[model samples]
Target: MASMDVSAQVSDEHSAARGHCDVELTHGLIITQDTIRIVDNNQTRVQINQGNQLLVRGQWIELDAKETEILEQYNQMIRDTVPELVELATDGVNISLNAIENVVSGLSDKEPEVLKAQLQYVEQALRNKFKRGDDFFYIAPQSLSKLDDFFAEEVSKKIHTAIQGSLGAMLIALGDALESREGNIEERINDVGTRMEIITAEIDKSLKKKAEQLALKSEEYCNCLNMLDNTESKLQKLVPELADFDLVKIKSDLQYSTH
Candidate 1:
């Protein structure tokens, strides 16, 4: 079993686009091929496993004779949905990486080896969050936060480094410009410096735009997972035993709220 935490902050646009109020995941969910486990803050554990098995607080629950019908219905729903969820998650990772690559590739004609390696690391990190073994796949709660950090922090840092590295080529161009002019070296130097500032500003503007795009994509991915919370709600309603047990809770907060 693998575990991770995922958090998503919705933008006004995202909320409007989905036609729903902002939502957040209050607790993490551990999803496997045949089971979904929710561990609350108080260390209370509730799990729904294959074959209509339910465990609460580490004890197997015995359903009433009439409850068997509800159990079977829940099991069938899970059996129909888990594979689709896995497919959607896998696709989400691929789409995110492609988005990152598109942003990073714009930095230079030929992408730096360092950036390529960083991308690989990111892919591996994301894949690690979704554990797939011989017979099961798992989605941990931490995966969304990792995704957010990858684009917001790690990728942003790499982009800045790569952009700064390109300044060396600019300096070489400055040298060539200075060599071609013989008089007024100080004036020429100042002129080159001003042009360099302009170039730097342009790079910064481009970087900011790319970063915004990445941030939006990250939020979009997180928003997609909101469906999982909806599923959890449905399960609770279907199984009376789960009425008080929150398999997954999503809450909305203002700090990460987007304009």
Candidate 2:
């Protein structure tokens, strides 16, 4: 992974300037704010717009009552979940920031402005990826991929730099504070270490709860994908050209794990 020069002055504009890489999906679905597009094995394209208009092979197709009902059902499903998904993502970001703050609070009194800035950047990135439009939301495989990269590359670097710059000062301050207390310096240091471990364990437990929630949500999402699969199967029966086009295979790329 290539590293970008992150300036000391962390700002929203700077974070926005470091735009995400383009993600290409040769196959499967690509969902945007108002459209859902699928590329099949034979390179055939299928698109459905917000108006429930279906397009295939560069031509718009007229839908019967049943077909229109299926499309409406799918659209309703997505609409209902969009807010819930946004809430979950927001909760995840809050959980992460709280965990970081907890750890920092255990170490020092100083605010972790840099770390918080980076986390805010992450939150904004997530919001952008899962943007809600007038009547729809976006969901693409690349959203997860981009977030993974943000954490692994950008966030990790900022965290490492922050720790390196502050850890020694934090330790010295902690040591001086503890020195005035009863116990020997070494024993007090050990006690502080033990307390830090306990704090870390508590943070881990909280994170696990969030993970469980995410797992449950992933199951619901998988169910939705299955319904979409069934809907597409019905659509294929109605439109023979789409018989070979597989929209649900995008679920495989999702790799949602209960574990």
Candidate 3:
């Protein structure tokens, strides 16, 4: 005859087995779902399905897995698509800054009629530029006053030169002023372009990092689902034979001699 040691915990005292095993897990006075299990060294080795399933066999192997079926509820937390972030930058310079710069550079070479035409062109560009917006460059507001001030200074100097009495002197003054102004304008454009390049690279880097993170998380989630599916299939195959289980005989088989 084999000896059995059993321990039972029942909140309101429920019927237990006739002391068959060494340890028995029972929670009878529970209002909600509870569990029955086998405890080995205070660790549960056999559990009657209540919550998450964690199996420990022998000394080293354990199988604990989560199912992604539950992830459907929180799937909305994952972003559907990575945003395409773009950054555009422009300063007080107009869209036609290049064209105006060309006109200014050639002012000394053009006749007064040509100068008048070029001036008219620049005037129209300024008007349109003020109304235009850089939709991509949304980080900062367009400094409208700053743009107006720049245009005002440029026009004031050029108009003053154009209205001079002597054509030779007028050409010299206009050429000098425009050259200086064009140099400054070129510097600003170059600066803006360089900054724009930096911004674009940063945005690209950020998007790439986010894509990698999303991919990694998706891979992990998929792996969890696969593990759960495999585990459930294996359990379904193994658990039905429980009707023929003989615990006392199995324990006797596992008993070993100590030196």
Candidate with top TM-score is: 2
Candidate 2, which segments miss by more than 4 Å at Cα? Answer: 1-51, 55-60, 80-86, 102-136, 142-198, 219-224, 239-245, 250-259
Name model 1 segments beyond 4 Å from true. 1-17, 21-34, 39-44, 78-82, 92-117, 142-245, 250-259
Q: Return whichever of 2 and 3 wins on TM-score.
A: 2
Ranking by lDDT: 2, 1, 3
Q: Give candidate 3 misplaced runs (Cα > 4 Å).
A: 1-183, 227-259
lDDT tens string, model 2, 127-208? 5444544554444333322334444444445444544444445566767777767868777666656665565455455545
Model 1: lDDT of residue 43:
60
Summarize candidate 1's per-residue lDDT along 149-214 as a digit string, tens digits.
444465445545544454455444545656766787557556645654554455445445544554
TM agreement with the true structure for every prediction:
0.42, 0.49, 0.21
Output the lDDT of residue 39, model 2: 51
Error of 2 at 201 (Å): 2.4
Candidate 1, poorest ten consecutive residues by summed lDDT = 1-10
The lDDT per prediction is: 0.52, 0.54, 0.32
Instruction: Per model, state how many residue pairs clash.
Output: 9, 0, 1
For model 1, state the Cα shift of residue 179 in Å. Answer: 24
